[model samples]
Target: MTDTVADLIARSNRLGADPKNTNYAGGNTSAKGTATDPVTGQEVELLWVKGSGGDLGTLTGSGLAVLRLDRVRALTEVYPGLEQEDAMVAAFDYCLHGKGGAAPSIDTAMHGLVDAAHVDHLHPDAGIALATAADGEALTRDIFGDTVVWVPWRRPGFQLGLDIAAIKAAHPDAIGCILGGHGITAWGDTSAESEQRSLHIIDTAAAWIAEHSRPEPFGPPLPGYGALPPDERRARAAALAPTLRSLASHDRAVVGHFTDSDVVLDFLASSEHPRLAALGTSCPDHFLRTKVKPLVLDLPADAPLEEAAARLQELHAAYREDYQAYYDRHATPDSPAIRGADPLVVLVPGVGMFSYGKDKQTARVAGEFYVNAINVMRGAEGLSTYAPIDEAEKFRIEYWALEEAKLQRMPAPKPLATRIALVTGAASGIGKAIATRLAAEGACVVIADLDADKARAAAAELGSTDVAVGLAADVTDEAAVQAAVDACVLAFGGLDLVVNNAGLSLSKSLLDTTVADWDLQHAVMAKGSFLVSRAAAKVLIAQQLGGDVVYISSKNSVFAGPNNIAYSATKADQAHQVRLLAAELGEHGVKVNGINPDGVVRGSGIFAGGWGAKRAAVYGVPESELGAYYAQRTLLKREVLPEHVANAVFVLCSADLSHTTGLHVPVDAGVAAAFLR
Candidate 1:
């Protein structure tokens, strides 16, 4: 098959999807094509390369900037200076075919200089691990024989492009170039050859590491730090939420969330974790996401909660100073004046690691990057000292204008911006809609559900791991409820919104209502909510920032019908809790509200799960028309959607209804009977 721009992107995605090849969007790819110049009216060679910040896994034609090949190659002599990053940015922008598209990768010239139809520059962990080793060049030569050329570490731009071109000129048959202490670049006339070359190098380096690296043998799992035990870490994290979040935020607009995945905890537990983590990111390219280093904390299991919070604040101040010092000591005269915001990852001994991002997807990506860092760092340390490129190179990559351009490519923020949300029963139905709406509006949502697998599936559907987190928590279980709250706080820096949307209904009348029926309904909607609210309120109060706890009550709560005793009574009980808790939490700047939705049976799942056919029978309507039947009963005469319920929850948590708390809002297609009196 003829290699097209799409084919190039297809191979780039293969390399990007695996962290072993690239983590996040830390790689670039390009394809050579011919396009008709609008002005010249003649066919011209064009280079379509992955733009800066565009993830290869999701790259499309738009993400690949189009530049005239001759114009890009001419920069070798026409460009004013090699050392000026600003010059490189302007030159790349000026060479673009049009305005309105993404900025080309800083390595655009390098891709064009490859003298092949396809070019791929990847930051595979194994390749970087091998490249950063002490005798890297010699090892690279030994591993790839004469098929790959070795290029010493150099600032990425004019000089590096020129260097690669020279190597290809000197070694015409070379399949790739090993960028010592950095990454590797593979090129070929077709996508298959270029991808195969990249895979071969990564596989070769991974095999070498496997043969030589003898990792530290861990003892049987010891309980994590102090009498606190691992089970209590989530609550401790929740207790520490406000302070840690304050520490992570430079502007306090974004939230830093927590994850205690076994991977992070195992890294923390490993004997060599401290030394490995201190060495910084596995590759300098990763500094933009993981930050230069993580802030490490050791909390005494039995330490006073207030004391721990205060101590963390002090430590974070120290971390900022240390980060600034590191910058001052290594930053060159040409480096960016602004220090990037606070560290994206934090480590707490006995607890686990926390990763921060502007949103949910960004946070999860940052967290997962650190997990990959741990793996690479561990392997490198076990075999040899974990050595990445020099501090200067790391700062260059971290502060590089090209790297910052990726963030700038994104559209305007949604209303929630950096707010964090935790929604229970978020695996499907009404809860899922709430999570989706919150994330779409720029909130980092946590999918808290009884089904662990479904929660993860829900999280994955939201796009990036950073945008949504899935945690299995039975809300009725006090410990689990607290942990879910902690997970939200830890994952997003601090929690600002809570949606008590998880509930089950019995739909039984007074006489038919079994003891178990009443108990189960109350267990989830009432007791479960109490546990979550108590825990969440503590964190929000400590943050001193106004937040919302919007309970998903029911219209039936206000007007109970026949055979709806358990569900209606339980919902009504929680509806009262909303007013009472609202009054109480208002003193702490926390708003407690309720969303009473009815006839959302089709999508709410509460109605569809055995209740739909029964509800249709009661109303003497076909089950298929039950939603419409209920809709006509209301003043609006419109079917109440799950999204409508989600909107009501959003309003309760948002500035639109900011002044109203202890208020029960109805979202039941305008049910006059359910309206607040």
Candidate 2:
């Protein structure tokens, strides 16, 4: 062994002694040596690791062991049926019980699987901060790239060894493998280089995370989140195996590890914990090692393990009920099928992960992954928000034919290609009507309006269960416009169509029009449309999801309107805006168009004032005869309502209008073609 190994062992012992390393016992170190068995003429490469019951602070050379590397590898390959911890123990017993040497470290197999001459595993606080983040993988990839290979979280032992073997095969030149949700593993030709690499990776990742990621503030405990007892934890684990298998693979084996009833009860009794039962896995794959869901214990502080376990069973029943409710609300007949009762990974208030898998290694990976995911979720509460994969999308992946075929046979249709739409002024009038109609036809609608209350109420009336949300925003405000677009993603996942239906018009010719009037008209009718359409274009471009933008222009835009200079100018500008937006967003799969409507007067507060009487008098017609006069001017002579304009907007927003852009569709009852009567 090198002097660097001695230094690392000393440092490891100190770190284990610190109270901050409550979970440090979970890690270990090992070395390679040569040993000769007296009974046979066999020379073997010995892998010595820290013993299971020993702490690093007080560890001694006697605490380590010498095991045959070749034998260990052969045993792992042939007895893939053994559980991770069990396999490790069995391997240790085989080497020590008969031969008369100290037992090897629990991580002996992990050390043996690596190609490097030296290896070190540690779970530093800084490393955990990065590992527990939702974007941890991407961050790691950006930082390390091919320098490291990442194995999803799992339990420790024979299974982890297998995972390492696969990773080593894939990256023959990699310096080390970072176990997701667990800690960093560093390996190199020499012990010093391995330690240096491990330290550098952890420090670099920690600094980047600290600078880029905002930490969520710890809040008061929620009302009911707590830990559970061993018996209940075991039952929960067994129940979750089937569901976990469905999520990952039915052919995958399931195994359980780390169900300490005492630890669970102790965690629940801690005063410095959250109140609500926030159940989730440490990592995405952790569900495989630990069951998808754990039971939340809700007992008083200082409750005994037996009491907590009994209470946890009651809570488990409640969890099942709640899971059913969530399923009923979100699931459809076409939804993908899942195994087990619930898909949650960890019970709230529990510290360790319970993993399940087709085999021990896979199960360990699942457990480790679950632990990391849970930590990330907890850490992310305030810094940023996260939503799980969409229910429908989750179903598609879980019950996918290709994925299921690998395990068992199943039937389901591929997810249908669905359209998404964003409708401004959706609180009332044309916008609301259009939103309602589109949602009825199986489209996701994001309703944006200046009136927040009305928009929310409209969405509620339409059914909150539908993929729809009401966003309050002034479209003319660039920031607000961007936020609205983001809201579409945060709520409905993405954007496919934009309906610029919000506008304002004032009757004033050039001489009567004030700067304020022009500005106001421009703000809503021109600038507002520009802001909203621009934001939509950005999203569609990034996603490459072809989409449409429909501008609600006016008939006055093309034909002259007396005393309507501000209104008409803005309307004309809106038409031009469509042409410009279309040109820019076209290559990015977004099309822009406009709709000009005439004589459509339903629920417009614009027509409710004395201006209507003034208009009627100016035209030398009765107030009721105003409609008649406009009708006579058209060849069709039919009245138009807001619904007609909304219908026209829908057609332009639909895929039927694909390949059509920079055109204006007029819903005017043929008024533009009529000569003076």
* Candidate that would win on lDDT: 1
Cα-based lDDT at residue 399, candidate 1: 74
Top TM-score hit = 1
In candidate 2, what are the lDDT values of residues 155-192, reduced to their tens digit? 55667776786787788777776676556677766656
lDDT of 1 by residue, 53-76 (tens): 789887777788888788788776
Query: Against the hidden reference, what TM-scores do the models get?
Result: 0.80, 0.43
- In model 1, state the lDDT of residue 357: 72
Evaluate residue 168 in candidate 2 and report its C-alpha lDDT on the 0 to 100 scale: 76
